[model samples]
Target: MLLSIIYVIGITAEAMTGALSAGRKNMDWFGVMLVASATAIGGGSVRDIILGNYPLTWVQHPEFLLITCVAGIFTTWVAKWVVKFKGVFIRLDALGLAAFSIIGCQKGISMGLHPGICIVAAIITGVFGGLLRDLICRQAPLVLHQELYASVSLVVAGLYLGLLHFGVSDVIATVSTLIIGYLLRMASVRFKWRLPTFTLNMEGSVH
Candidate 1:
């Protein structure tokens, strides 16, 4: 639950960043708000649907939508002043990634799944929402890039699993995972560490 709040806050920050960017580029206020709301919640909605968790967070707590909209308005209004510190968006995004990864893993564990499944599910939960946002923006997903993106989530998930095995409380495991994932993502970006692109040919056919 704490992780969920962190996830919401992280996405909210991203939404604001996206809104400000759009507004700076001369997008109308409505367009800016729409883009912000979409970026903030689109991924989680899809994740809930896929996981068969009916009545997603936004649906159950309609305030999620209301909050997102209000945040969009606030971002649009203040974007001109806030655009100077663009680097902050990266930090917020990393924090969000870590929070969501822990929440995802914890959610899976609560559902009584196997450890491996829980870890994989956690990684997906952390990433799927951002993936949706990128798809809508017509950009490649972060994990699909050569960056050490998904790897950070995977590592966090592994760490969370280890913590659980050692009988750590969910809160402890989650907080630790969030920190690890956030730091890993930040370090990867700062150091320009990334995964290698792979190419394979099968029987003269490129796949």
Candidate 2:
């Protein structure tokens, strides 16, 4: 049930971000919907494919696609009016990250994955959707930036993994991770806190 709610919120936020970007780029309705759909399901689709899950989640449960479509349309219609308040978008994105990261870590642990791999998977799951969204919109991926964005996912996933390692209940671990992730993200944005970027005096490769 918690996972379901998180999925809905994540999908809706993805649609909203895609819609906002599309409007800013002057994309047509079709292009907007494409971006919205991609942002909404790109991560989960990739994860399912990696896990060798056939038919994918949205494919097996087509209602998810319908929900994404409706959210895309709704965001497309309202984006212009709310464009000035981009902070709302950021907050929604952070919340989505917190929710999805916890869910991903839980799923990974349930599937008997290693704690380290589960943490990695959780970070990927949280960031991949937004990364694709930005890429499709011709912007830099959020995870590639010198921000506390992906760090939030890693921190939350690490906490969850630690708890699970100690044999904590799944619900408690998931909720604790989600709350900490969300709070940290909100505080980071509010205080403009970010992970420091590494710089080399040699000015060599950028990787």
Candidate 3:
């Protein structure tokens, strides 16, 4: 129940962000919906495809797809507010990333996957939606280039699994993971923390 609630909120927030990106590109309503839905659920869809999970989440629960579309359209009406308080949006995005990571981890655990595989699943779920959105919107991929995004997913998944191994209750493990993951992401943003990045330029020498 707790995970379900977070999943819904996560996708809604993701859809809204995707809609904002579409707005920046001056896309029409259909384009907004496409980008928004892709941003909201693309990660899980890709995960299922890779994991060979039958009947995708949106396919099994079409209502989730409807929710993403509605949320995307709804964002258009409040784009100004969303832009004005971009900090809040960032916080929500952090929460969404945490929730998505936890959910993906849980799915892998349920399938009796290895801990390492679970961590990979979590990172994929947490990062791929925004990745798809950026690719579609012609923007640099934030997860690839920006602050500690995929690392947060890795941390959350490993922590959750470790907690479970130590005999923590599911609810407690989940809640603890969410809180810590969110804080980690926000701190990365506040402190401009990032993984080392490699750069190449015309004037730079390379091996």
Candidate 4:
């Protein structure tokens, strides 16, 4: 139940940020809602599809979809305020990322997946929504270039699994992962910590 509540909050925060992105592009209301829904639920949908889990979350709980749509529209009305408080959104996004990672790890464990696969699930849940959002908005995917975003997800998932392996209670493991993950994400943002980039320098190679 706690995880479910956090998941709702995470999706809602993600949807609001997605709406801001849509507003930046001057999208219509439909576009805002579309992007919002994609950013809010695309990751979980992708995870379920990859795992062959039937009856997706939004399909099972239409109300969650409705919440995203409503949150998107609500963001439109508070565009200026949202922009003004962008830092708050960043913090919320970090928290949401941690929550999503924990939830994804839990799901993978429940499915008896390998630990590495569970980490991948966490990465998908934490990162793919933003990827979908950027794709829909025609913006560069932040997860590919941002500061420790996907890395944080990987660490959180691995830590959660490790805690379970060592006999930690589920609740304690989850809370610990969430706190550590959130702090790592925020610190990365603050410190501009980033993975090394790969660049190709080809000179007149194409015919």
Q: What TM-score does model 2 achieve against the real structure?
A: 0.87
TM-score per candidate, in order?
A: 0.82, 0.87, 0.95, 0.96
**Candidate closest to the true structure, highest TM-score:** 4
Give the Å error, residue 15, model 3: 0.4
| Candidate number with the higher lDDT (1 or 4) | 4
What is residue 98's positional error in candidate 4, in angstroms? 0.6
Write one digit per residue (lDDT tens) for candidate 2, span 21-52: 77778888877777787787777777666766
Give lDDT for model 3.
Answer: 0.93
Alpha-carbon runs more than 4 Å astray in model 2: 199-207
List of clashing residue pairs for candidate 2:
none
- The TM-score, computed over Cα atoms with residue i paired to residue i, of candidate 1 is 0.82
lDDT for each residue of candidate 4 in 2-24, tens digit (9 for 90 to 100): 77887898899899999999998
Task: Give candidate 1's error at residue 162 in angstroms.
Answer: 1.8
lDDT of 1 by residue, 1-207 (tens): 676677778878867865764565566767776767666776566556666777777798887777777787888667766677667877888898777667677767777878787777767766765665565556667567745777787898889889989999878887878888888999998898988777775786656
RMSD of each: 3.5, 3.0, 1.7, 1.2
What is the lDDT, from 0 to 100, of the residue 151 in candidate 3? Answer: 93
CA lDDT, candidate 1, residue 148? 79
lDDT of 3 at 70: 98
Enumerate clash totals for all models, in the order shown: 1, 0, 0, 0
lDDT agreement with native, every candidate: 0.74, 0.78, 0.93, 0.92
